[model samples]
Each structure stands twice: as structure tokens, then as C-alpha cells.
Target: SGVSCEFEENPCDSEPCLNGGECKGSQEFLHCECSTGYTGERCETKIDSCEPMPCYILGTESCEGESLSYHCKCLPGWEGNGIY
Candidate 1:
């Protein structure tokens, strides 16, 4: 007679994520939650939240992304346009 035990493998061992992304184990794959300034399926790309430079408002307001939404922030020594 003989007995055996099965051991589950750790999914994070291969480290599929990139750019300091936090890896979460799912059933068949990993779920990567990107850190600040990064976004993608594996967090392998850098986030460009400040694109197009929405500084048209007298060159004051700057556009940046907060999570999935964008917002305007006044530059140094600048004031808000009251539209935020």
C-alpha cells in the first residue's frame, strides 16, 4: 500500500507582470493591478496621463488622469478655472 499528496503550484513564480505591478493569482492566469503612472493588461506600459497638455486656458490648467478619468490641475503660480 502507498499514499501520495498533491501540491498546488504558485502562479506568481514566473512573474508575468511588469513595471512593479502587483500580481494576483486567478484560476488560469494572473490579474495585474498597476501602480501609479502605469497601466495595461500586465502593467507593462507606462501611463501617459498628461497628454495633449490641456494648457489652452491661458496656459495654466494641466490635464492629468486619476485612475480612469482625467482632471485639470493648475500649474505652479496658476489658478483654477473654476471648471474642475
Candidate 2:
């Protein structure tokens, strides 16, 4: 009897990785290595750094963490950018 070999398709060929994420593994296994400030299976989500609130002043500063960068802003009636 003769043996036959089957060809497997690479998952990365579809360009599964997003947001500059790197695709890894073979047909048996596939995953996305997301870049900075990115998450999810296909790296489709942008991590929010302000979610935990990095501002030093409680209720006095506004934290804006969009993707890879973060900034703190003082609320009204307050002074300084709150970056320190």
C-alpha cells in the first residue's frame, strides 16, 4: 500500500494578526503576539492604561490613557497637568 501526504494551510496566510501584531505558530497552532498597548486574540483591542487610574490625585485629576501613551490632567479649579 502507498502512503499519501496532505498539505496543511498556514493560519498566518490570512493575516490574522492586527495592529502590527506578529503572527506565530503553524497549522496545528496559531496565535498573535500583540504590540505595545494591544491585546485580544487578533490584537483587535487597544489596552486602556487609564482604566486603573494612574493619576496621583484622587477625583482631582483626569487620566487619559489612549493605547500606548498616558497623560494626567488636573480637573477644573485645580492647577498643574498632574503628570508628576
Candidate 3:
């Protein structure tokens, strides 16, 4: 006689990973691989590069921050890329 077994549900079926995180594993367990600029157990936290403020003269108000880098806004009368 052949034996029959019940099917097991995958833990990742619910898609627990958040914020562009990739889920890996199977019915046993799952983990999240967060994308750039994001961190935390579920990738919910966005890394702020401007916390320390790298801009000089113009201060943090004119500081443009990204995931891993920052740019300073040009002073008044200055032209080119600082307008944005």
C-alpha cells in the first residue's frame, strides 16, 4: 500500500518582506534581503545620509541627501545644478 502525506504551506506565501525586500526560504523559515538605502528586519527603515549634515556655509537646509551621498546647494546668484 502507498502512503499519503499532507501538503505543507510555504511560510513566504504571505510575502512578509517589505520595502522592496526579497524573501528567501521555504516552509521551514524565511528571510528578507533589503534593497539599497533600506534596512531593518522587514526593510522598513530608510537610511538617512543627511543626519550629520555635510554641507558647508548653506547648512543642512540646502543639503541634498540620498542613500549614500549628499550634495550642497549653491549660494545665491550661483547657477547650474544647484537650482534643483
lDDT of 2 by residue, 1-84 (tens): 124546667889899999999999797899999998899999999899887777766545578777766788877776765553
Better of 2 and 3 by TM-score: 2
- Cα RMSD to the true fold for all candidates: 6.2, 3.8, 5.4
TM, every model: 0.52, 0.71, 0.60
User: Which residue pairs clash within candidate 2?
Assistant: none
Q: Once model 2 is optimally superposed onto the true structure by TM-score, how far is the C-alpha of residue 74 displaced, in angstroms?
A: 1.6
Candidate lDDT scores, in order, read 0.68, 0.81, 0.72
Pairs clashing in candidate 1? none
- Candidate 1 lDDT, tens digit per residue, 1-84? 124546556677778789889899954777988888788898977765546554456745557665445667766776655243
Clashes of 2: 0
Worst window of 10 by summed lDDT in candidate 1: 1-10
Which has the better lDDT: candidate 2, or candidate 3? Answer: 2
* C-alpha lDDT of candidate 2 relative to the true structure: 0.81
Worst 10 residues of 3 by lDDT: 75-84
On the 0 to 100 scale, the lDDT of residue 22 in model 3 is 91
- List of clashing residue pairs for candidate 3: none
Q: Give stretches of model 3 more than 4 Å off.
A: 1-5, 52-62, 73-84
The deviation in Å at residue 48 for candidate 2 is: 1.2
Say what the RMSD of model 1 is. Answer: 6.2
